[model samples]
Target: MSIAWDDALKVGNIEIDADHKELIGLVGDFETMVKSPKSVTPRSIQITLERLQLYAHDHFAREEYIQAIAKYPGLAENKRQHDALRKTLADYIAKFEAGQFGDLGKAADEMAAFLNHWLMSHIVDVDMKMRGALSDEGWR
Candidate 1:
């Protein structure tokens, strides 16, 4: 199933929300390819997956930097979560390289699940707290 973008995914941060929207769109595209037998190709899926991985790293780095400048107290834990995701994605990429390209379907599904869980839980639960702290510090 494709993940739909909705207001529930927003964190009230304009820049981050825009990035999240784009990320969701990419995830949706991957889902579409996963279910389309005629469109599936190792090259295409690898490119998409690599793009997502690169963008994820860039997004996380930018977020961490912003959180740091904003004096978000939970930055450490948030950074840890970012690191964990990077590692997991790297592992998934390795699996693709090992003649498991057909696993794109499973990978896409798992990625969608992780994205939803992480966004809702981390953005709302943890990230919001950090944002509050940052605002309190008059950093934003």
Candidate 2:
């Protein structure tokens, strides 16, 4: 199944929803790069991973800030989830730098697949919860 972000996946707030859409697009792009017949070099993978890292960092901070302002009850859990993912992404970046993957192509493929699965699950299980919680607190 493709990792997608659609109108039905919206989580009430426009900014958060937009962030999710961009993140989904990024994941799809990374997966496409992995599946491409073109030579997937370590440099190329690093570039995309770096983009994802920066984007996720900003998105998570924005999201958590909103959640804090709205007094969303799930704010703590959201922070925990975001931090965990950040660590995972950082670990992958470190592994890439250390050339520990042996087969960069295979490692890139694995990370792409994991990102796809993780993004969708996170949207549904964690981020989506913010819709109701934010609404309860009269957040947009």
Candidate 3:
């Protein structure tokens, strides 16, 4: 399945929206790379996972910074979710390193689906709250 970024994913913050777009693109690239298992090595997958982790870290920091600046009430919850996602990514990396998933394509498909769902849900349900706060404060 191909995932595309659309208006539904926008959180009403330009910076966060751009970051999410980049993240979605990265995840799509990773998904494509893994779909052709024979064409990519395990090391390649590891690198992609690392890249995703790094990008996610940066994105979370940016989002948190905005939330802090805006005094967003849901900042704590956002941080909690971000931390959970980081842990989940780490677990996936560990599993990959351990050769726990023999079928890389299958694993990638699952990972892509999870990431897509998590991202969309977070943007819509969680991040949108920040947008609302910003709107209330005339920041949006």
**TM-score-best of 1 and 2:** 2
Error of 1 at 119 (Å): 6.3
Q: Of the candidates shown, which would achieve the greatest TM-score relative to the real structure?
A: 2
In TM-score terms, candidate 1 sits at 0.77
Candidate 1 deviant stretches above 4 angstroms: 101-140
Model 2: ten consecutive residues of lowest lDDT: 131-140
Q: Summarize candidate 1's per-residue lDDT along 32-89 as a digit string, tens digits.
A: 7767766766777778778888887887887787778776677899898888778877
C-alpha lDDT of candidate 1 relative to the true structure: 0.68
Across residues 34-124, which tens digit of lDDT does each residue of candidate 2 receive? 8883758888888888998999999999999889888888889989999888998898789888888877678877888878877876788
TM-scores of the models, in the given order? 0.77, 0.89, 0.85
